[model samples]
Target chain A: MRTLNPLYPTCPIRNIINRMSDKWSLLILSTLNQNNIMRYKELNAAIPDISQKMLSSTLKRLEEDKLINRKMYAEIPPRVEYSLTKTGKEFMPAVDMMVNWALEHFEEIVS
Target chain B: MRTLNPLYPTCPIRNIINRMSDKWSLLILSTLNQNNIMRYKELNAAIPDISQKMLSSTLKRLEEDKLINRKMYAEIPPRVEYSLTKTGKEFMPAVDMMVNWALEHFEEIVS
Candidate 1:
């Protein structure tokens, strides 16, 4: 049996949940999942409500966590694109489950 | 294809994710899953780091969302207890998946 000590900040479950539970991470991840790859501008366009600062910070955090990859081109204007890493791809099942559950129970939950 | 317009505040996925993704909800739910049932104080004690106000509000929100049941007994002083509702119980598979994934990828994620 796995004993969960949520009080422990270092606990994997705590860390992962805290990271993924942030306001924009899931929205960004799911958008990448749907689009396969997107430029920074495109991502900003996709989640229009996200402020530029929040999108940049969230993307940096996600990149640091290795859930998403950031690639930059050396062109005159420069270009950057984002996509999920293998681990990020592996993490989608859990996200999908949550999405499905939300769809099924949304009415009951909000009513 | 199910279109997810996360910008819409009423979107089910957005609403559900925002609620569950709150700092304490997942921890509280998982704690309840492990304990089966508990009182307000027991829950507060179980999650030692949580403030009384936070625990109280999170529990109330969970109750309001129908994810938890709050039962009251008419006794000398009155007794109240908490347990997962049927829908809450049904939601465990997704949580389990998250737990498993967190355990499996913890090192890779943080390293």
Candidate 2:
């Protein structure tokens, strides 16, 4: 009898891609990519369709993943903003590739 | 009175990433990236945790998305091999970045 290699079975590539590949995550990342930095209301306005719950949860996940940074201001009203981290910036090229691929193959794919 | 830009609201980046970011899809793509070309059994062996049903469905989605190419050889047992298409190959650098990011930040994330 032979045993399977436990190390080979755990897939980090799948894990990371699964985390980052959600609809809102990619959209939020792309939105941030374009705007560089945006406030919560700004993000909500920029991507009109996302619900507040979805946006908040996705932002939280991305922040926890260290791909995006969240900063809160001490103003009386409390200003909060989000931006890509250095790692997130490094991830933009990959995002660009995905966007370019999608744009080029859009018709073929959606048809 | 104002109207929203419908064009701006439809997110292709999100659509494409959502399609590609599933667990098995990422693993299969990474396996194909490493092996370049592999038969059904080879892929199954390469990614151990994936159930046969999950693998088959992921392969179909990837094929439909045109990210992978499936070549069938008529033999007594019938042989099918899979490889990344040009687009899929182009997508590898992004995969590399994801893997690199995972390696760099795994502990921070897992803890």
Candidate 3:
């Protein structure tokens, strides 16, 4: 049996994987991967049917884990944008594998 | 961005993977993969420090997800043993990959 090393004080990779598998995070990261930065609302709108609350929470956790960067440009309307951190981009292959695996096998998994 | 298919109206593979990463499931399955079947307390004891409730809940979830089979032998002490289901075994390669990735990359991911 293998033991997990707790990351930082409280973070665990299991927790990280859970956050990565969050219904919104995969979409959000995949969306942001194309563009360096994306406005919060723009990303949300692009995700198609994600709840605002879910998007907010998922982004917050991803940022906390340093997987995504949340930058606020305090302009006229307080613009906030999200982009993948180096760590987040590194996991792109894994996440892409996950998505592709999902596409290929979810039907088989479901049936 | 890739879209996730909501599996079976509720059971998403994301959910399944989350459960698979349940801190106990991987160890539990890895333990059982060796012996094919084991009693609840025996598996718990083999896990070193797992709580009874946690083992129970994890096994219950695995059973509910059809990843495992629980056979209760109507003995004087009410013997019960757990074994992996067919679908569960198919996921062995993926789970092994996860464990290897965790063992190999978790340190890098942490620091």
DockQ of each: 0.41, 0.35, 0.17
Model 3 over residues B4-109: C-alpha lDDT tens digits? 3463343343443444555577668777877898998789788766778888898987776667899999899899989998866766665555445444545554
Q: Tell how far residue B5 is off in model 2, in angstroms.
A: 15
Give lDDT per model, in order.
0.82, 0.78, 0.67
Q: How large is the C-alpha RMSD of every model relative to the true structure?
A: 4.5, 5.9, 5.9
lDDT of 1 at A48: 88
Task: Return the top candidate by lDDT.
Answer: 1
Which parts of model 1 are misplaced by more than 4 Å?
A1-10, B1-10
Residue by residue across B1-108, what tens digits does model 1's lDDT show? 233444584665567766776658888888899999999889888878889998988989888888999999998688999999988887778888877887887777
Global local distance difference test of model 3: 0.67
TM-score of chain A of each: 0.89, 0.88, 0.79
Cα lDDT tens digits for candidate 1, A13-74: 56776787665998899999999999999999998889999999999989877899999999
For model 3, report DockQ.
Answer: 0.17
